[model samples]
Structure formats: structure tokens, C-alpha cells
Target: MSRIGKKPVELPSGVEATVSGQTIEVKGPKGTRSFKATDDVTFSVENNAITVTPRGKSKRARQQWGMSRSMVENLVTGVTTGFKKELEINGVGYRATMQGDKVLKLALGYSHDVNFEVPEGVTVTAPKQTEIIVEGIDQQLVGQVAANIREWRAPEPYKGKGIKYKGEYIFRKEGKKK
Candidate 1:
């Protein structure tokens, strides 16, 4: 009954997948990733395509059907094309720079600079003072790192000054009447 679950995930050339028990592992040019699904769903790989099927008609089974399918797709995509998150810095003094190979130095109007450590398995780069690029084979990790950076100085409404995701819109508000 799940539309998304019904569609099989097609594996691109040079990408491989293996389903064992409740765990599915996908390997590709970029890297390898694995996901373990609940017992409510089953995974099957055939003809370079992965299909997820619910074991019963229960609500939990149906829910796992779509969730498992999407997880498999993400693993495949993560290993192949990887993932990227872009962040933009606002405000006059707000900017970011790579301190060295593993640290990011951010100036966001704080009395002192904010030092953000880059975690393993992900790459953080600052192409420009106003731009930050987060890239990795794991989609979730890439997004989490970007979010952590944005948390330092979330965009405000008045001047829209702060760190924000690229293309994000800030709803502005007028100042209080005198």
C-alpha cells in the first residue's frame, strides 16, 4: 500500500548491494554504507534492484515498508554521488575559514572566534569567507554538520544577519514603533 516502497531501487553500474538477514550493505565508487531494517520488513535484491516488502498488513509493517526502502536508496546514493550541504554567513563580521586541516574558524560577532572541529569521514571546506561547504558519503552526517554550524548563529529576522543554509528564506519583521 506504500507507493514509495513499491518502487524498487535500481543500482547503477559499478555499484553493488548485498542483503543479509535484516541488514543491507551498499557499496559504490565513493564508499560503502549499511543499514539494518526492522523485522517488520524484508529486503531482497534481484537484477540490480532492491525491493522492500512488509511481512504483514499491520501498521508497523506498512510503516517499515517505506522507511526501509528509502534507507536502502539513501545508502546507494550516498555511496555513489555522496552528499553536500552549503552554508552562507551573513553580518559584517561573520565569516568562516579553515584553520588548518581539521578545524574551522568562524567569526560570528562573538568576543572570540568559534572553533569547530571537523569530524572524521566528512570534509569541511571554506571556498570563501562567506561560504562553507560540507561534503561526505553519508547524507545524514553531512546534514548534521551543516546544522551544527548554522546553530552557532542562526539567521535573525531584523537584518537577516547570521549563518543560514544556502537558499533559505528569512521572514523579516519591522522594528517596534517609537
Candidate 2:
């Protein structure tokens, strides 16, 4: 038996969930999200809670059992509380600014500024010159966008200069002795 699959996902007050076919829809103050599970698992909702159970004792069924439950949990969390990712720019003259609505202008010591296009369902904001905040109802999208932004200027260990996640630790190495 899967530990995570056994626990039912509780629906908070003001939150709603409906199951139809293989699709499960969750609606909350933030937004509404839906997910469709495979036939390997079964989904049921009762007592303001959602549960996932495998149809048979097969490898695939067992795999889908836990995954389907987690996906449903994510949907609830996304619609209710949403998700956020913060980034900190570290290097000299490095900064970020929001251009117009969906464009993010970044200066990372390069000769030209990098323009990052914000995708739909995700909001990118630059609260400060060195800070960037990415928010979205979908947890995967939020994390992916933040990762793409970091990929542009990943922190270098030499001087610990570049863009990094908030509270991320960068290992420092001693420079070569002259």
C-alpha cells in the first residue's frame, strides 16, 4: 500500500471538488484546476475529501495510485493557495525589471539585455532591481519559469555572482594565490 495514496485530500471551506469520468476538478478562491487520471487508478470524493485507489495489484496500478493522489492534492493546493518562486540576482550591475506586461528585462553584465517572455498562467514581477518573483496557480509552471530564469545566469562559484533562488546557499572556493 502507498502511504501517500492512503491519505485523503481534505477540501477546505469555500473549496469545491467534482469528479467526472477520469477528470477531477477543484475550485477555490484562487482559481479552478482539473486533472485526468489513468484507468489504472480510481478516484472518489466523499466527506469533503478525495481519495485514490488502485484498480488492481499491478505495477502500473500501484504507480498511478500514488501519482494520481498527489496530482489531486496539487490541484487543491494550487486553486486554494497558489505557488510562488523568488529569485535573487547577485553580481555587479545585475538587475531585473518588468517591461510592459509580460516581458522581463534582465541585465546580467552582458553587452545586451536579455528579454524573458512570461508565459500564460504565470505572472513574473520584479519587486526590486535584484529581486524577481514568479507566481502562478500551477506549481510546475511556477517552478519551470523560475528555473528558466535562473538558467540564463546561474550563480558561479568563483565570485558567487549570478542569479540564484532565495535562501539558496552557494559554495565558495578560495581564489588562486598570486
lDDT by residue (tens digit), candidate 2, 63-163: 99999999999999999889999999998899999998799999999999999999999999999999999999999999999999999999998999999
Model 1, span 124-178: residue lDDT tens: 9999999999999998999999999999999999999999999999999999998
**Which ten contiguous residues of candidate 2 have the minimum total lDDT?**
36-45
Reference-based TM-score, model 2: 0.97
Candidate 2's displacement at residue 24, Å, is 0.8
lDDT score at residue 22, model 2, on the 0-100 scale: 91
Candidate 2 clash pair list: none
Give the Cα lDDT of each candidate. Answer: 0.95, 0.94
